[model samples]
Target: MIEQFLTSYFVKNGEHLEVPPKYISDTIKQYTVAKQTARTYRNVSFLKVGQLTKTKPSQELINYKFTKNAKRKLTEDFSTIQSWIKEGWIIEEIVFAQDGRTAKAIHYRIGPSLKYYFDAQNEQQTQRLENYVLQLQKSADIQPIKELLQAVQQLNEFVAMPIEKLAHTTKLTPHWSIEKRLRFLHFSIGFFQLANEGVLFDFKEIGATLFDKIGGSKAFDRDQKEFIEELERVFSVQTIDCGLISLGKITPVFFTGELMGHLAIIDKVLFMH
Candidate 1:
């Protein structure tokens, strides 16, 4: 329950707040009471931030004893919660009374360092990318891609093709079938993965290359625009002008996950072959 409270607090605020020790206990009590009163009352807000004071806490809170085990659990839960924050994850500052004999309140805020938190996020993002690839494979038409990869591997005459020529030569019909579109996306994914690895220059280059793949400037304007739009939406892709006198230059803003090493699984045509 304490962990949930802390997690939600971080998610909602994405900042630090000074919380009273008694307030935490009270909040937990409210949560327990809410659960008991109504099963539907599952989520309770814990956004309250208390001001620190040099004076002693009120008698009611002082009389309210927080268990030693509970404190330990809260500490452990906070350590776990800190793993989720990317920025100043959490800073705990103890405010002591003027007498210097007793602690007053603990100040919580975004801190400066949390290396392990980002490491955890990277692992999760990588896993998400892997899962996305696996899911994409289930629906994407990839048999032709596999065969094309094999053929390319066996051929020595075929050097890597230039982006402009490929776009100029290949022409998309007025309409694209769903199967054909998915097949095209399969290749786009390969290009994106390659770009992620720094093998390709960037998203703009990938865009221009892909723009040509879909039939270049000669293709119908509506179809080309729609295809490019979908690519941008799915992969955080963007297009740029390389002064090629056309939409031959492109760039990508971001790729979701790291799948460069696992090319065979993500996109076999470019990486596997």
Candidate 2:
């Protein structure tokens, strides 16, 4: 579901998925599915209308692939050439520059092979199908994953707010990488869990940062208290004895916790150079 969540995050409210079909393929591989479902597709569908007229004269010579994937070898489907011939005549087997670089590809024009592939009977339907791919590319994205990590760093730099305050002040978007952000949120959740038990205030009787004083400076209202109660149920964390806790786990022990969370969060998303 993380993959679906990430894919939907990019698409926003669109019907078609993004282009570079490989991204979708890669994302799908992350989830549980039959291996064949992920691996069983023609690598690339390179479509180009061949310019030379002497061969087919009336036919358009094009690669068997309607989509081009740079990583896929043009050779894997060379056997498919026979399959193509089953439906259409092979005008030529040649190597030509695709995107202006020399690459081996089979080019054939409109014929029985392509007829079923792209129904000539319905021209408008074919055009819409092409437009759909173009729109899909604009939909799914990877930038937000990067953006979230940067945003969290900025928030931590300034102030230490409660969970609700943090969410109110910062934007945390969910996607496949959402678990990355959730890890950061979870670290604070442990502290709030401690606070609910009054362990923070109890330890502070000796000495501690002001933030751990819960109802001290940034006090918790009834609604916020209810939130932590829910968070407890959601994460299913248990309360531990404050006497058994380390000083670093309690402060305003939050700075150390936040720091740890941030470092762990960075690793989960894009790796830091």
Candidate 3:
């Protein structure tokens, strides 16, 4: 009964409800059991709000009545409410009443995971949620990510080959600058990662940029074809339609720890040159 009332309240308001015990006591006094229970508990477990409808609460009257036992049941459910607080579903705090500091109310402020309570609602509520998420994303720290990438690049397990060694091994042209070699290696790693993830490739755009100094579309097609052929020969990658098709041979190995370590090495080799 409490859950139904709260759901309705949150959906209608899309804001925190100052629900006192008396409010619950009064609300549940309106309806009978079996029928209301059958209507409200439609296979949804209590507080599993995600499975429920993504609609705002209606102004329609709720018609459930609470018996004496039902009232007792509500009181005994404080432990469940406390558990919600621990799980961060609800934020609880005390605030002084307008009249005096002695008179306090336990304010159930909505937490960051407030989306779970209500679904698709008014533009105002949706905008509020979007703004909140944007603020959080804007405040997010990226230094740790850079540090982790740097660490991956430094680790020997992920360092397949140093730039000089790689150039020598591949027999890259003598005229190729270290910067150009690095760029080529990075592109190879990116191509492999994309293919392994079964992503589609846009050969025209990619080839135009990478092979721009060499020639036009035809040269790009030739170079990318060679690149794809080498990948198929070495990594056993499967592709069709001149490498534009999704490749899948590496997908299964992509998540394995050893393969991931090698991928990190590829990332290192990509940048080191």
Per TM-score, the best of the predicted structures is 3
The lDDT of each candidate is 0.36, 0.32, 0.36
lDDT of 3 by residue, 182-216 (tens): 43443444443333334466545343433446453
> Model 2 Cα RMSD, Å?
22.9
| Residue-level lDDT tens digits of model 1 in 1-273 | 333434443333323222333334321211111111332322222222222222333333223232221221123455343331212233333444544335565444422222223345557865754554454454333233332443223221111223223223223322554334444454454444333333424334444443456544333333455655654544344533211123433434555764445445444333432
| True-vs-predicted CA distance for residue 174, candidate 2, Å | 16
Count of backbone collisions in candidate 2: 11
TM-score of each: 0.20, 0.20, 0.23
Q: Count the backbone clashes (under 3 Å) in each candidate.
A: 8, 11, 3
Residue 43 local lDDT, model 1: 24
The regions of model 3 sitting more than 4 angstroms off are 1-160, 170-183, 205-222, 241-243, 246-273
lDDT of 2: 0.32
Compute the lDDT of residue 88 as modeled in candidate 2: 42
Q: Note the residue pairs that clash in candidate 3.
A: 31-64, 31-65, 158-265
